[model samples]
Target: MSEATHSFEESFDWVVVGSGAGSFASALVMRAAGHSVLILEKTAFAGGTTAKSGGVMWIPANPFMLAEGEDDTLEKAETYLDALQELDGGAAPGTSRIKRRAYLENGPRAVDFLVAQGVALRRGPDFWPDYYDELPGGCKTSRTVVAEPFDTRQLGEMRKRLRKGFAEFNVLLGDAARMGHMRTNPDAKKMLLRVALRTVRDKLLGRSFTTAGAALQGRMFKAALEKGVEIRFDSAVTELVRGRDETGAERVTGVRVEGARGSGTVGARLGVLVNAGGFGKDQAMRDRYMPGTRAEWSLVPEGDTGDLHREMERIGAQLAQMDQMVGFQTTIAPGTENDYVLPGAQSLTGKPHAILVDQSGQRYMNEGGSYELYCETMLRRNESVPAIPSWAIFDRQFVEKYKVADKFIDKKIPKGWLEAGYLHKADTIEGLAASIGVEPAALGASVARWNGFVHAGHDADFARGERRYDGCHFVGDPYADDPARGTIEKGPFYAVPVVPGDVSTYGGAVTDEWARVLRPDGSVIAGLYATGTSTASVMGNVYAGAGSSIGPSLTFGFIAARHGAGLGNLA
Candidate 1:
């Protein structure tokens, strides 16, 4: 069938492509500058990945912390960022530096702007340790902030323009609904008991009861709407329009967007911002750029086809870190699609008690390391798959102590996984490996070594019990002396096969500190900017604190908008 067409005569001083935090923040900045801005979103709704994310923006040494009597400084923040760069082994220095400066310097301003635009900010301190506490200026501090619970009903007609699916927002809303049901009906025990308990705890602490991802996105969405920014959904920019200016260089003129009924061209007098997401979900691009991953395992939305990246590439934009992608443990769910098992961070869940092994059944790096490192290590090992599907082999003691992300006591493990023969349950290590088609002898030896470390309260093979890594902790027993150690001595052993799952790919088109897309010849692509997961992420390989992804996305997006408006040179 021929592509659908949509036409309209609309012009804006600024045009933003994508609706995540970055695009929304940039659009707000431009609008604040007294420019009429139009935001084009490919999906039916706005709030790209930002709506589905945790909504914590990681801004080290932010003013919000200081206002709340927390101690943080730019120098200390820089030290922490530098420590992360050192861990990258100099592979992403530019990304690290740009993101660090953007977040450290502009973070406070970004928060202020959003708050002024009706976004409520609550001081949500970093509950986990800093990834580089051993380095100078690296200590856990209250540097994160989450938006207050926003009522989606406030959006009125605008709510219809949001991307709807299993996006972060939807996930949060779904979970919240379940939680809310439990709160109103205490007699409905079982799973509802957990929900009711969480609701009461949050309410008692004066925290927003909206714990799901949607609440996070809703806050940003509410802030953007209050700023008078108009979002056009179902609008996919097909091609970039450029022309020669007085400086004998190319400049963006407008964009040709294809929609439902017809196609139309919209012009931007100031600039065009491209925040379209990465090419993770695009099989052809995945094969060409990231050959190591299984193309079918992407968890991104269907709308994320990398059209913006390809369009920019045609115009001679430079790309960086194309080989890198955000990896996580994933599994093939029968009848549906591949489902990525989210990372178990100290903040989200708790320290992992299991170790990740390769197909040969040998331990690799620390299982509690950053997911970025996990992905890199998996690729370096050259496993049969880009990321080998492995088991989180733990004894009964682990299951009794810590709660896994989705493996609650009440909910039955999905039949798809059990029937497909991916999960293995056995009373012994040797038997468990046999059920999963691994060599019995190799699995036995691996388990024996791990068991020794668990029993001795030390992990010499891969330091499984070490809590030095900030990402290693979880939400469970924080008071446990050996936070990372739990004896695997229970009789009935369990094995859940997990493959690598990523929130989103971090590598993309390279941009400057102001989020301006640079050309192949080291010149700025006039009127062109990018943000969110579409640009090389500023975090590099280290996840410094919670909300790291959204933090840079908003900060750089603000910088890009100000730069586009010639405000970067002010003061």
Candidate 2:
């Protein structure tokens, strides 16, 4: 609990917290509406966990999709979103019918506003289907929007302050997705070469460049700075300053901040928006919400320690769906211990010649489709089966054909990975089973069954590559006749422990369609707003598409700023 500070050292029309996707978008809206907006970033960097992410925003019926002649509409998107709700078994308050309508109606407008503001955005890959494109109203083509590659050199001295992304290469999201097919596809090889050449040329010219999330944030940071949105980095909001309104209801008036200058109260004349991210780094919060999940498996930055989440809780903000996370399945490679960014194994497990199995050496669920579903299944399966850390079993053919940990695999295994027990290898199926502590016959049976599927070109037990997302070039081999099916009967077999990892926690304070924070009784906490992972996700518990997390974050933030600035939902 925090005492309401009566006085303040500084005041702005709108005070935004956390420099993730939502922060910049809302601040831009505030500035455009001629209000004094201040973005308070807890970390030195401009972008929060978003900068380390894929940076794709899944906005159905977006302008870019429509402009490309893709058949999509808000009604279609509504059906798609509605169809996914049944998967949760009930209506989620966070993603209520009104909230869903709000997102669909305003999402395109938000993108339009960004475009009108000169943010260079484009549609994602042509084949980048919705995670559940097979579902009703789901488009087979992409509904994603991503920022173009940005040259950070344009940021001047602030370039150093912008956070780098998870990917080291300066490749577009589409090109990066195709990079997995470099070995098998000629076009993919050319794309890789082009990116490599661009990297070398940029290096020689002393020009710094970044792609994906970094690129998006870099552009947003530039736009925000240009719009005169004052951003104070290292300024953490430790408490929310509340005041009673004429109606006897508590309203957030300001924030108690701890930063480089020291502790002080910063008041907001309009309202305070807390887009300060989720509690991915807090073990206690994880235990309380998502039990049995370790904070170490999270890829959120150090600053995502739930400072504002606690503050919002203290101020009586309703927190919903606290157990959900944007799961990005990962494998522990050598030197990856304790690192914020671990190599994701979503591609590995979905690729041909590979299958995930439990301790008893039996395949359970479909190893493809959404990574969120895959990891959630892993955690749920652990209740009855020993599958917290499942084994991804493959053969030498897979190693030679595809990438392992996003690196090209050669004939010889990495010695450090093998020595540190991060990777296990054996000559025969029985030997591999013995090494991984599973019954040899069981392991052999699973492999033989999977091989039969590969030969028959259909998975009867668990359809591996059934989904459009599963058969994508990145998840499966591009050259193979059936991209997602291949036999695992080569000389030496390999295995790695795959854990349910995440980019960020997905749940937090509950907010309305206006992006205003709400109390348990469904009353709005006037003068308080939230978006991004700071609020319970708009998609409820399921990941809608490639950029489900970032898309809703950015859209709701846009809505919040408009409401706070008295603009009212961009007309």
Best by lDDT: 2
Query: What's the lDDT for residue 254 in model 2?
Result: 87
TM value for model 1? 0.85
Per-model TM against the reference:
0.85, 0.97
lDDT string for model 1 (157-202, tens) is: 7656554423222223223323322222343356555656755766
For residues 1-571, write the lDDT of model 2, one tens digit per residue: 1224366788899999999888899999999889998889898998999899989999988998888787899888889888899878877778898898998888889888888887889888877788888788888888989998888998998888899887756677777777767667778778877888999998999877888899889999999999999999888888888876556666788888998979999889889999988999999999998887888889999888888788888878898988899997888888777665788888898888899999999988777778888888998999899997899999987888787875666666665988888788899999999998999999999999999998998899877777788788656765777778788899689899999989889988999999999999999988999999998888998988899999999999999998998887544
Worst 10 residues of 2 by lDDT: 1-10
RMSD after CA superposition, every candidate: 5.8, 2.1
Off by over 4 Å in 2: 1-5, 204-206, 245-249, 338-340
lDDT of 2 at 333: 85
